[model samples]
Target chain A: MELILSIAIGTLTASGVWLLLRPRTFQVIIGLSLLSYAVNLFIFGMGRLRMDAAPILEGAGSDPANYADPVPQALVLTAIVIGFAMTALFLVVLLAARGLTGTDHVDGRER
Target chain B: MGALFDHLIAVPILLPLLAGALMVIVDDRRRPFKIAVNLVSTLTLLIVAITLLMIAGGMTASGDPARTSVYLLGNWPAPFAITLVLDRLSALMLVLTSVLAVAALIFSLARWHRAGPHFHTLFQFLLVGINGAFLTGDLFNLFVFFEVMLAASYGLVLHGSGTARVRAGLHYIAINLSASLLFLIGVALIYGVTGTLNMADLAARVGDASAENRVILEAGAAILGIAFLVKSGMWPLGFWLPTAYTAAAAPVAAIFAIMSKVGVYVVLRLSLLVFGPEAGDSAGFGAHWILVGGMVTIGFGMIGVLASQGLSRIAGYSVLVSSGTLLAVIGYGTAPVISGALYYLVSSTLTISAFFLLIELVERARDAGADVLAVTMEAFGEDEAEDAEEEVGVTIPFTLAVLGASFAGIALLLAGLPPLSGFLAKFAMIHGMFNPTGLGDGLPIGAGTWVLVALLIVSGLAALIAMTRSGISIFWASIERTVPSVRVIEVLPVLGLLGLCLAMTLQGGAVIRYMDETAASLSEPAGYIESVLTAERVARAPSGTPDPAQGADEETEVAP
Candidate 1:
């Protein structure tokens, strides 16, 4: 499970960084989305890749070892919400830049 | 009164938040009403900030130098809860942010607020974010506040939308978005290694981490430092700052003067609190890189200042110089030097912000064509005829005179010349470097110290030269320019900010003493950790076991 997740994260980050370096605004936005996806997964993995464990306490005095740590899941949830908002904001800004500058290039000018 | 004071730490975050939400519901067409709401909220924030400062200062002066007032959100226990810790440093930053907000909001009243939709709302939300970032003691909460701040900043930067603003805003958002991703990864890595997100608890656990865990922790810290360095406008990572800042509207640009400092503040806080001497294996981790990066940033800023053509761009580069100085000084890592850096932070922020405000007014006198023509004439040595034809002893308009005087004051302050807070800040810093322990005798001054001193002096000289050149072209050579119709409201904020710098110069001793104590408290993290981790949850009535669902609802009710 760890191996699969790590490889997934690495591929997503590598692709995201490559696309981020592209000059087009749309590509950059997509790149940011990919990067955020990778980050979300990474944060999720921080809880140590638990399977078949309750995320919350079953009852008082229950063994915590049988429960998955919920903090990283909560963190990932917040990161996803923030990431969604940021991507939305970036899309609007990208559209605005394209409309105002008459170019989709990141620099807002043709080479 | 005492109970109210306990919750004062939360007010700075909540007040602006409520105001922003309220403004969102108000009709944007009711501009005056919206302005009134913003003004009231900002003024109240200033009052709260000042009261907090006084409380913090009083605490520092009394028995406990490192005493902190912690407010637990949702009445949760310290490590499990989001806490707001108000010590001398956070209080000082809160006051600074409020002061700048007041000036910027007042200045925006002239014209910029009407340039875009939802300006007042965005402004209020920005304050909420900045205040929250300063007050929150949890890392995750800090990230949330940072996002809030950045989100609002994006809207404000693109507020008065133009091709320039949109283009600059594109780069700004992309860079910051990437930085935010880095922040998340770094934070998660640290959490995976340490099992805690509360800063004080993290600090405690960091000291006892195994060697392998220490390596991961340090790596996390370094990544986190990079994220902050990007925000702080450190060398290489901060190339986006000048263009974006120059493109922002005047008031927006002015408020952004504190934005970079947020990064610096976090760096200072974490370096001292988490990785200070108590952290066994990782003591002083990454200090060398910070020092070297800061010096290079100073060099870069000096060149950028010299090369910048527009006054606003120079102001932007000046922000870099200010950030570089503070970072370098903080990296030096002595109590007295850190105190001086704190003073420098205040003085430089005020001066740079005032300069940003002054640039718009000053640029008003010369039209765009004339600005280009003047630069061309100077470049081609064709200004002699204009100089010869200029009339002698032309009476300067009162507005022009005031603008020119303020321009000179900003120049002197930026250049670290005598009789201004800038010079005094540098003087205090140098004095501290010479006497690190307040004793006449200390370790011999090192070569790195000499290099930093030289850089500070040279950076000041570069600023003086750049300002003089820009001033001559705008005020001296542009004699044929019409005086821009200036409003009293517009000019007052600029003068007020400059006057505050002058006040800082006059009250140097008291301010320095305050900074000295603040730095002393920062150098010792034991009290900070003790106060934070030991803060008990609020006591409740003894009853039968409550429903978990009801308990969750109660937590939400107690929030704010």
Candidate 2:
């Protein structure tokens, strides 16, 4: 499970960096989204690949280690939501920029 | 402090948040209503900031220590809940933000508010983010507040949208978004290794990390440093700053003067706290990197300042210089230098903000056609109309006089000329660096310190040259121009900011003493960590050991 998750994050990050370096605004936006996905997955993985364990305490005497860590899960959820808002905001700005500049280049002009 | 006052720690973050949301609900057509709300909220924020400063300065009813105050949300114990820590440093930053925000908002009232929709709401949200970033005791919350700040900044940057603004804003957003991703990854990696996000908790755990985990932890910290350095306008990561700041509206750019400092503040807080002398083998893990990067940043900033064409770009490069000085001085990691840098921080921020606001008003009077021609000539190295008829020299007009005076003041402040806070701040830093008393670490003067000193002086000279050249071209050389119809409201904010800088110079003694104390407190992170981890518990239960809330598995709970 850890191997698979690490590989997924690495792949996502690699693609994100490639796209981010591209000149087109759309490529950068997609890159940001992909990078955010990798970040979110990385955050989720911070909980150490928990499975089949409830985050909540079963009882007062229950061993805390037996339960999954809930903090990173909460953090990742927030990151996901923020990432969504970030992508949406970027898309709007890029579109507006394209309309105004009459080009889709990141620098708003042709090379 | 009483429980009533305990909540005050959170007010700086909450008040602006609620006000921002409420302002969003108000109809944008009612200009008077929006103005009124903004005024009242900003005024209230000012009062709250003063109150917090006073409290942190040791005016608490319970006679609690002045250095650290912790307010745990929902009355939860420290490690488990979101906490707002108010020490002298945080309170000072809060006051600075309020001062800047009030001035910028008032300046915007002159004309800028009409340029965009929900300007007031975005402004308030920006404050919420900045204040929250200052107060947050944990890394995750810092990230969240950073995002909040950046989100509002995106809207604010595009407020008075133009081609230049859109282009600059696009770069700003893209760079900041990438930085934010790195911030998240850094946080995740740190959390994975240290198993805690609370800064105080992390400080405690970081020192105890096994050798295997140390590499991962340092990697995380390095990445985190990169994100912060980018935001702080360090060289190589800061080429976007000059364009973006020049393109932003006057008020937006003014408030943003503090935005980069937020990065500086975080770097100082985290570096000294987590990786300070107490971190054993990891002690001073990234200090040399910071010093080298900072000096490089200063060198680049000086060159950029000298190379820039306009007053706005000059102001932007000045930001880089200021950040570089602070970053490098911080790398020295001495209490006295930091205290001096803290003083410098306030002085430079106010000066640059004043300069940014003053630039627009100064440019307003110039002939638009002449302005474009001058820019084109500057860009293409072409001298045109050199043989044209000469004009008679005359007394500087009312508008030019005001601009000239303000420009001189900004130059004096930026260039660290005598009889101003900037001079005093830089002098204090140099004095602290060479303090014969050697009370702090007493580390012998190194080549790095000498390099920093040289860069500081050179950067000041660069600013002087840049400001003089631009100031001459804008006010003296340009011939065909109508006197800018200056408004009292517009001029007042610039004067107010500059006046504040002057006052800081006048009252340098008291302010430096306070900053010295703040720096002393910051150097000793034990008090901060202890106060944060135990403040709530101590309040609820006097006995320290075996509190029912903290189970035997403190390690387990703190870790995975």
TM-score of 1: 0.93
Q: Which tens-of-lDDT digit does each residue in B389-485 have in candidate 1?
A: 3323233359888999999999999999999999999998888888887767867999999999999999999999999999998888856668876
Q: Candidate 1, residues A23-65: lDDT per residue as tens digits? A: 9999999899999999999999988988899796744567999
How does the DockQ of candidate 1 come out? Answer: 0.63
Residue B268 shift from truth in candidate 2, angstroms: 0.6
Highest-scoring model, DockQ:
1
lDDT of 2 at B480: 73
lDDT of 2 by residue, B1-560 (tens): 56687788888888889888998888987778888888888889989998999888886566765758888776668977688999899899999999999889988886677666798999999999999999999999999999999999999998777677888999999999999999998999899998899999888888789999999999999999999999999988999988898888889999999999999999999999999777878988899889888899999999999998777888999999999999998988889899999999999999999988898787776565236324433433222244122112132348668778988999999999999999999998998888735657666887877888999998999999988888778778868767765667778889999999999988989999999999998899988889988875444455654544455356456654
Model 2 segments more than 4 A misplaced? B59-65, B368-397, B436-444, B537-560
**What is the DockQ of the complex in model 2?**
0.60
- Weakest 10 consecutive residues of candidate 2 chain B by summed lDDT: B387-396
Instruction: Report, for every candidate in turn, its global Cα lDDT versus the true structure.
Output: 0.89, 0.87
How far is each candidate from the true structure, as Cα RMSD in Å?
6.5, 7.1
